[model samples]
Every structure is written in C-alpha cells, then in structure tokens.
Target: MNRWLVPALALALIAASAASLLAGTVWLRPQDVLAAIAHPSDDLPGLIVLQIRLPRVLLAMMIGGILGLSGAVLQGLLRNPLAEPGLLGVSAGASLGAVIAIYYGFSASFSLASPLFGLAGGFVTASVAFLLARGGGTLALILAGSAVTAIAAAGTEVALNLAPNPYAAYEIMNWLMGSLADRGWDHVRLAAPFIVAGGALLLATGPALDVLALGETQAESLGVAVGRMRLIALIGTALGVGAATAVAGAIGFVGLVAPHVVRPLVHHQPGRLLLPSALTGALIVVLADTATRVMRLGGPPINLGVLISLVGAPFFLWLVLHVRTRTA
Candidate 1:
C-alpha cells in the first residue's frame, strides 16, 4: 500500500467529520460552511457552524486518530488480531482513574486533572501488563492484561458505588458513556500534546515493530532491541490511549476493530497497517460521534459507547469462538 494513501484517507475522513459537524444539526450547505469558516460574523448559522461544530469535529479526528494508531500498535506488539488498547486493561484502568477523579470532585478543581489521572492509570496498567507479559511473550501479556482488567473493573465498580454524592453516579455514568458533547478547546489542548508525543513515539518504532513480527529470538538476533522497543511502544500506547480516553471516556472497539478493518488494506503487513488503521479508527470514531449527535433515542442523544459495544460485543464473542476453535 502506498504510504501516501493513509494520509489522504485521514484527510478525507477529517473533511467528512467537518461536514458531518455542520450538516446534521442545521444542514449547512458546503458553501455556507466554507463561508462561515472564512468569515466569522455572517449570521447565527455561521457562528454555530464555526464555533460549536468545528471544534467537536476536530476533536473526533484527534481521538479517533489516536485510537486507531494505538490499536495498530497493540495488535502488532501482541501479535494478536484481537489485541486492543482495552484488551490490556489500559482503557479500564484509565476509566478507573477518571472515575475516581470525578467522584472526588477533582474534575472541578482542575478539568485537566481528570485526564492526567486517567493517563497515569493507563500507563500504570499497560506497564504492569507489559512487564507481566514480557518474559513469556504474547500469552503472558494477554493473561496479565486479563487479570488486570478484571481487577481494575472491579475497583471502578466499587468506586462508583461508594461515591459520596448520588449525583456523582450520574456524572460518572455520563462520562463513561463517552460523549463528545460540551467538550471544548481545553480538552483538545490537554489531550493533543500527549497524543502527538505518543504518536511520534509509535511512528518512530515502526521499523522495530516490523522486526518484532519475526519472533522475539529472531528479532533480537537481527539487532532489534526488543526490550527497548517494547518499552517505547508501551509508552506510546499509554500516552496515546490515556489522552484519548481522558477526553473521550472509554470509547470502545476503535482500537480492537480498526486494525482488523485495515489489515487487509496493508496486506497484513504490520508496518503498513499502522497508518491505515489509524485512519480507519479516525473514520469510525468521527462517524460514530456524528451519529451520536444526530441520532436521537426517545428525545435524548444516544451513547456512542453503547452503540459501538452493541456492534462490537457480538463480533468479539465470535472472534473468541473462532480463535478457540482454531487453537483447538
């Protein structure tokens, strides 16, 4: 696959996201959107088009892009088609952190603190799982991740139950559902740097990931720094996922499914798949977010996470059965 194609696809998704932002609520024509973007004070439509929708659309691009890239990384590293950021309990851990922050009212003190804590939680979980899986390779990592996920999820539930205020549960519930509504530049600003940094790290490790495909002993024999490469990839995942989960609040399936969706486009070449997966992830999230805004359920906005899980959970179960049968 031509590398240029990935960027082109990402750009197209971004354009679509932008269009979706303006189209659904008010049905702004493309020319009017362009005009509104160009000149800020034409009318209420112009203002709403530029101010309200554009930022959200851009945020969707960033979150989706990050999830896609990280998903590709996780899949490549674990050598499992089923691997996702959530698979290793990183997303759950981040959610736990965010939940704690929200429950304790830290979010009010510092809006950015929620995500920072979430990022920290993601990193700790991924690192721990990575370490547990380190010596034994893929199987060990999967087991450790599973264990961690169970533990973290239990912890999150406990925190939710123990919340001081009853309304805290509602707030936590909303956050967990992963909406892009009411998010502003503060979120973008908080998440962008970490995502960019993490993305850079992942991109830099592409050559190493290619080597890793050859098996650990083979990779090490070929002058690949397996340990360091794993560390770098883990850090990249932490930053990328942490930032994304911080802002998006555990939007599932993008990491798990995006790589699978794009793998064929890259001919199953790990390195080639990375960018395309990223683009596909971006497309999925942006499209889902757009749908969330436009698609109403009984008069309120629907939850994006529920929508994804409804679709993904069945696929995930089928995947599990398929993997087991094949292994058997």
Candidate 2:
C-alpha cells in the first residue's frame, strides 16, 4: 500500500498544482503556464499567471504543508487527537503579533516585520504553555494550552479594539479572516526560511515521538530525552505555524484534518503519518484556493480561511461525535 498511496498522493499534489496554474480568473492554458514560468514579462497573461496566481498557489501549498506537519507533530507530542496548533495557542499567538503590527502600521513600513514579530509572539506563548504544562500529564498540557489560547485570543481582540479608525479596524478584522489575495514572491521568500528550519526540527522528532507514545517512563527506559524531545516539538510547532500564520493570517484546520486523514493510511503510526499528512495538507489548500479563484461567478472571491472553516467545523463535529460514540 505504501507503494501505491505515496505515489498517488504525489500525483495528486502535482495534478492539483497543475490545475491551480491552469484554473484561475483568466484561465491560462497549459502552454501559457509554461511560458509564464519560462519568461515572465509585462504581457497580461505572463504577468497574471507568473506574477500573481503562481506565487499564491505555491504559498498555499507551503503554508498548508507547514501547518499540516506542525499539527501532526503536536498531536504526536501531546498524545491528543483533538490537538492542533490553533488549539495550542501557537496560531493565535502568531495572529496576535501580525495584528499588533498592523495596528501600529508597522506592517506597511517593513516587509518582514509582521512575520518576524509573529514568530516572537508564538514562541512566547508556547513557552508559557510549556512552563505551565511541565510535570503534568497529557491533561495538563491540554489545559495549559487552552488557557494560553484564551489569553492570546483576548490579546488579539484588544489589538482589534484599539484600531485607529473603522477602516483600520476593518483591515485588522479582515486579516483574521485570512486571504491569499495578491500575495507575491516576496511573501514566499520571507516565510520560506523559517518554515524550512522549523519543518526540519519537526521532522527530526518523529522517532522520539514514536517512543513517547509508549509513555514517559517507557520512553526514558529506551534512552529518549523525553523533556528535550517535547521542547523541540514545542519550538518547532511554534516556528512553523507562526511563519505560516504571519503570511496567511490564521488559515485554520489544515493541520488537524490532514493528520487525521493520513493516520489511517499510515496504519495509525504517528511517526509514519508525518510526511503523508504534509502531502495531504498541500493537496487540500491548493484545491481550496483554486476553487476560490474559479468559482467566484458573481460574488466576491472567497477567502481561503472561510473555505476551510466551512468544511472543518462540520468535519470536527462529526469526528467528535464518532469518537464519543466509540468511547461510550
């Protein structure tokens, strides 16, 4: 099954990427896409395909992969099926930073300021959550995360509340709604390095996580540094999700859904679920963003975050019901 499933997911990613390039407001042909990539120029088709949509598509894929992987890593570390970066306060922390930047008009002055500050905020919140969760069991971690999430969320609301004017307030509010509109290569360049570093750290934790699944006492018996391993995962999730949220503004649920989708395919091993979860996440965001561009027949373009929330809320409800039924 690995032979077929991995390749199939790869093909799906590739196909979805191709479809993203071809299906847009202008609807470029296959050759048009190739040409735009080869020679980006001032022409309408070249400028539209190369300058606008391509970067947005790549951004969606990258952000999706990062969020998906971060969610999988956190779930593994915490041993909680409902765990995700958002629920852990990482995404909310990042959103708070970006919102603060916008509130002060710092985002307009500096291209990289929002994301960098977002990273700082995520680390701070995750650090606090870690400190609170230390020495406690799984329940402690979740409760601590919940507490931090509420705090960070309240902070974000404060930032929004203090917006200088209604327009500024609308911008701040809309940023939380999350759109990929008009994103360029600059956003990609700014976000790519942090995601790469964070993803590397996350990828390294898989073995330790697998050991961790056996319980802390058993993990220590197997020579795993349980404390250090959790630290790495905590930091990695903060970094990756912060960077993604900095650019994408709190696109939700990709990570939570992606891991659940791939877990059964990987036979329920958390370690093996990581890479496939990333792939599934890339597929989801690309397709969702694509629909946003093409399916705006008469209405305004759909925000990517809105699309995910529309699907995710229902899916999450169903998952909760299913899990409760099984436990009952």
Candidate 3:
C-alpha cells in the first residue's frame, strides 16, 4: 500500500460524490450545493439537494464501499483472487431475506425490518455454505455458493408467483432491479451503521487473513484458528452486504471488480488492499449512478443495477478467461 493511496482514494470519493450531487436534473452550482448542505432554506433546489439527491448519493457510495470491503474479505478468506461476495452467494442470500420480508409484508409495517431479515438470511446461508463444503477448497465453496444462490432465486420467484396482488409483485420486481433514485435519508440512516461496523469487522481480519495466506496448516500452527477466521469473514460479509442489498437491492460486481483494480496499486497485499478497494468501490458506484442519470436525460430511465451489470458482466467474462489462461 502506497502511503498516498488512502488519501487519494478519499479525494476520489469526495470528487465522485460532488459530481453526483451536481449532475442531477436540477442544476445546482458547487456553491449552491455547499450552501444547501451548510445552510437550511425553504427553496426547491435546496430541498432537492438536501432531501432527495444527498441521500441517494450517500447510499450509493456506502453500498459500493460495503460491497468492496466484503469482496476483499472473501477473497482473502478463500485465498482466491476471483472470490467475491456475490459470486459466493452471500448477496443472493441477503436478497432472499429481503424478498421474504416483502412477501410476508413485514416491510410494510417497519422500514428497518427488511434489512434485518436480509442480514439474518445472509448470515445463515454463508455459515451453511461454508459448513456444507467444510475442508473443501475454493472450488467447493464456489460450487456451494452457486447452489445456495439458485435455491434463493427459486424461492424468491415462487413467492413472486404466489403474490396475492399483481401490483404488489410489480412493485417488488421494480425494487429488485435496484435504483438510488428517490431514496431518502431514511435509507441512508438504515444502512450506514451496519455497513460501517461490518466493514470494520472485515478489515479487522486482515492480520488473520495475512497469516492464512501462508496456508491453513501454517496459520493454525501460528495460533490462527482457520475455522474461526472464516466464520468472522462470513459474518462480516453478511452484515455489510446484507444491509446494502436490503437498502439498494443486489448491485452486483462492485465487489468482484473493486479489489482487483486496487490490488496491483497496493502491491497485492490483501491486508493493505481493503481500504483502497472500499474507496474505489465507492467511486465506481457513484460514477455508475451518475452515468445512469446522464443517460436518462434522453431516454427511459435506466436502473443503476442494470447499468452496472451491463458493464460488469463483460468484465467478469474477460477475467474468467484471463484466469483460465493463467491457470492452464
């Protein structure tokens, strides 16, 4: 990790956030944005900036950062460069919980209930996934995660099929597509504490991860319990990613992409890669969302989730090809 990367990432996050705040439908100057944040007023621009755009912007950044941190931790846990929370089915598990909340109408009663169920779903599935493939390597974990994701997806679809009202199902479907548009401070408040705390938990495992990189036997000899470390990583990933999916739906590939982009910059040190990956993830999402708004200027609005998938899905294939070539 270069001494300067964290500060640089911080700067980039700030720049991206600023760009997002200014890029919306209502034009607000930099000064206007500053005044809107620093001063309270009863004007439309002020209301738009403070109430509508700010929460969306913050949530995008936070969700991206959470995904990034989770990705890095999972990669470190599995000791596989290609490992990611979504690819490992953690995000899908969380989304399953959110779907259940929506189906059962728990979300109708309390705004926070959905996220809590999401957190629990992710936690349980992650634990179960690892336990199901205990003593198996990265490939086993990947296979287990694929199975978990498929089951969750099927369950969600079944619920949607059985939804009592067409309108309710339609709303749930739209929410699943993911967008920061029209989000409020309530969303930000809902996800921030869990994200920050969960990210911290993941990052805290850096030393254990570094040790485990030496191989499980070596780490165990050094008093690092491999099982415990893996559990911690899963819990951290579940908390952060579950909260994010709860609030923003499943925004894919931020995790898979962020750490890879930051690894070389950080000299491939897993411990050092955490913060930069998180910051870069924040940057990726802020910009993706900004692009979404820009494209919407001339066409039907595109969802942020769809935009990231279009871009990331290709990148994922390229990565898979590259990895295969190297391994072969």
lDDT of 2 at 7: 84
Clash pairs, candidate 1, are: none
- The candidate that achieves the highest TM-score relative to the unseen native structure: 2
Which lDDT tens digits does candidate 3 get at residues 1-328?
A: 4889999899989998998888866777889888988896868778978898888889999899988888988888788877877765677877788878888888889876667777777777777788876887656777888898888888878878998899669767866787777678988887888888888889898888778778878989999887777767766777788788878888888898888878878777788888899998889899999888878646668888889999988987887787578669
Residues 33-131, model 1: lDDT tens digits: 878878888587787776777777878888888788888987888787767877777888898888888988999888777787888888788888887
Q: Tens digits of per-residue lDDT for model 2 on 203-257? A: 8988888887887889899998877877787777777887888888889888888
Model 1 TM-score? 0.87
Give me the displacement of residue 300 in model 2, in angstroms. Answer: 2.7
lDDT of model number 3? 0.82
List TM-score per model, in order. Answer: 0.87, 0.92, 0.88
lDDT of 1: 0.80
Question: Which pairs of residues clash in candidate 3, taking residues 3 or more apart in a chain or in different chains?
Answer: none
Off by over 4 Å in 3: 104-113, 127-144, 297-299, 317-328
Q: By the lDDT metric, which is better: model 2 or model 3?
A: 2
